[model samples]
Target: MAAANHNTVKYGIIGVGMMGREHLINLYHLRGEGVAVVAIADPHIPSQQLALELAQSFNWPLKIFSGHQELLNSGLCDVVIVSTPNMTHYQVLMDIINHPKPHHVLVEKPLCTTVAHCKEVVNAARKRPDILVQVGLEYRYMPPVAKLFEIVKEGSLGQVKMVAIREHRFPFLVKVNNWNRFNENTGGTLVEKCCHFFDLMRLFVGANPVRVMASGAIDVNHKNEIYDGRVPDIIDNAYVIVEFENGSRGMLDLCMFAEGSKNEQEISVVGEIGKGEAFVPESIVRFGTRVAGRDAVQTLKADDDRIKYDGLHHGSSYLEHLNFLSAIRTKGEKAPAVDLQDGLISVAMGVAAQLSIEKGRFVTIEETMAEHKF
Candidate 1:
């Protein structure tokens, strides 16, 4: 196996959907890091063809499979990236964890559709210490976002008090089979789309979310679209307020119909002493102390020269793969930056927010976790 000697890491990507293909492209850019994508598994024929064309470009002869089990049974991968749909995460993750061979994993985010499933995967992974799994919460690796994290960690912001993230972007892209068109499959819009922001909020606050209060509905987008005789129930816009254990707060303002917006994501972290902000796509960050006043604010373009491919996610996906590869090559010396616990909490936060909107009140994370007796 490629990982046995830790010389070259071989990868297999399950569900070669949009995000999975992004992972493939990111790995392709990381070829200099001693990595190669050896295989891909996807039941959808069109997705397979698209990925095949990509692999052929890289001169990578791939072993394609119709299902994840076949990919696992083949023993062709040292690390497997699970970018399957939100609802399928648990089953695919369980199969990988239970398989005789311990293949390290980098599962795309939200972790699972529900808190119960996230906890199940977390517990299942806990039993396999030899296996390393990372959730693809790659937003943290975004240059501007990473710089903001640094500013906070360096105590320049001084005990962060609030984090407000606004993502005003286009609607979700069409996925294979249109599995993302409904709440049942995508875990609703908040859990499916806003998990990244929720994860970022937790990171900025440096604490787990205690409760979430949200207000949202299917205001626009996919109103007339019907798939399999059902209209899409996924919410298109929402305002979510999260309270962290540290008494700090986080807010997310999401809109799927705002294509005219200049910046897709605008994150502001305010501390007791100062404030810092990150703008995605613009890749800009601004910071200044309260005493320094507005005149003293410093702004800069954020860039990480290590990124060889700036894929769909503003180069964060490339950095994410690099970080995972380093952890795999280091054996037990390093751990995944985004562990299962991080994944679970992120999903839990999203779930709490979703439930909060449903119940029209604040939903506690404790109760959300207790759903499956976690």
Candidate 2:
């Protein structure tokens, strides 16, 4: 309700589902940082109950609301975490941006299901200087990934030429009403799940994408499981190729059925002088130059001592909250680590890749943005 201060920074969470609960717990761990989850809004009784139980464990007295508007009306929060379903992000974000009260936001990734909605959110947020909006592209905060970023920035991986990321993980979990099973809701597998990788690709290359080409389908998961007599159309696996404006290229190899893999994600960045690789779960980073050879490559375990909570995202979400809280306390002196443009471009890359798959051709980022009229 009041301005961001050194005092307790109150928070409200909309859509207390899986990711919403993650934010709740993250804020809980940051209680010593003057953070608290003061309120939560979720229409689903089950999700509400689960979040309430979590709040009770944290000894937080929450004012529960069935909808976000009610939570905003109560003036109980200085910041809000929007963890709603994908399709709903557009409207929920618009409402938050339009609300008179300033509520800094950390919306979960994808920004919105469509590029047009993301553009509108970007424009709307630009008007609200009082409100700081940070998209939850938490993968950037992962210890291993963050380490790779440092190496790249330090010029350890000189003149980056290619970046490749492989995610061999299980299928998407069942969300409220199984809404994630369709392309219309989740923005297809590329935008829905691979946006994280796309974001990482952009950072590793340090350039904007120029075009994308992809091939994927619903080949592995949710084939026989039908929801309301309609089978899922969302692709479960894909190989996406992104061409950047700097002539650096990126590739994504995704497989939802490879649950047997040791590491959930493995990323490699190859430049002119050296190459660096990071592995999630394994939490490892390796770097080597041509002169050093593969045998001489050094390996180290990636870890952030500042991370107090290691949640579902390998402590990235916790790290993200730490950064967001610091930025908030600065009172806009510091900007969000991942801004709206990063979110928009990540979605655009995914959208281009998705379109590429549908049309069986390379989709230029220019062409994709032109269609959105942004």
Candidate 3:
């Protein structure tokens, strides 16, 4: 991608929380390189102050607003990045989509809190093809994962057989100050966080998931472990198995309460000819033969060979902004860094997995769709 021409693709960020601030910093760097962030909005006063400070500190002429509606109504931004809460995405998106100026939207992962809202967004986006509504599924932009996709597509790993992704984090114990904790608001653990992996699985297999089987329980984490003086429904850890249409399969293991020992967010794929594995925390890619006669694994430091940026961290949110600018400048023809339907499908997979866990049976994608029709 060439340098983003400043004439098009003016950027703005909404909800300046952790992720939103990261976007602001990324956009500051982009501004130094010709791209501009003309405006920003967040309900929190502290967030607004931070945005103003960033604009002043970086010598950028950016407007700050207290709410997303005000930001959209200002007509200052050509493109908007919705970094609001999961439950708030649908309404904010609707507001932007309905605006006369019609700015393109780059929404955060999971797209929305429910499958119905996801479908609504997709339908609305379809009606107005001019307004590009992209969902932020950043893992697809990861260099090692991108390389893995290339290898799989080029037959370096012939016919992917299975993929296993393990995500072990400290806990969801942190006070989110929003709807991330409650399942009704954030759509539970899978939809809130692990949807990235679900989407990645679909992309890696290059096929849609046929069915999902899952088993989960709230084994640990939380002061009030019991719901209403009994047991809670949400699971702290779970294992989900996804069967794809291409006769391939994927497995996801999530543990939000793995105290002590090394933490990891790892993904490994096995194919007929060879295997490719990536450990996100370690930033390593291991590839080796999986044949019956020759089985070996050789690891390489993926960080060393990554596409370097000026001031952007390896796994930061900056890459997505760069990709977004590229997409806008290049129109829709270029390879989508992240698209809307992909995000919707990812959330659907999570919803299906949760349903499978509750029902103790395999659930199809279609069944999930029918269950939550928009």
lDDT of 1 by residue, 1-374 (tens): 35555578899999998988989999998988889899999999999999999999999999999999999999999899999988899999999999999999999987999888988898999999889999999999999999999999999999999999999999989987888998888878888888889889988889988999999988879998988899888899999999999999999999999999999999999999999999999999999999999999999899999998998999999999989888887774799999889888888888888888888889898999896532
Residue-wise lDDT of candidate 2 within 85-105, one digit each (tens)?
999999999999999998999
Give TM-scores for every candidate, taking all chains together and pairing residue i with residue i: 0.98, 0.98, 0.89
**Candidate 1 lDDT (Cα, whole model)?**
0.91
Candidate topping lDDT: 2
Model 2 misplaced stretches (Cα beyond 4 Å): 1-6, 372-374
Residue 121 of model 2, lDDT score: 95
The lDDT per prediction is: 0.91, 0.93, 0.77
RMSD of each: 1.5, 1.4, 3.4
Q: After TM-score superposition, what is the CA distance of residue 230 in candidate 1 from its true location, in Å?
A: 0.6
Q: In model 1, which range of ten residues has the least summed lDDT?
A: 1-10
Which of the two candidates, 1 or 3, achieves a greater lDDT against the reference?
1
* Candidate closer to the true structure by lDDT (higher is better), 1 or 2: 2
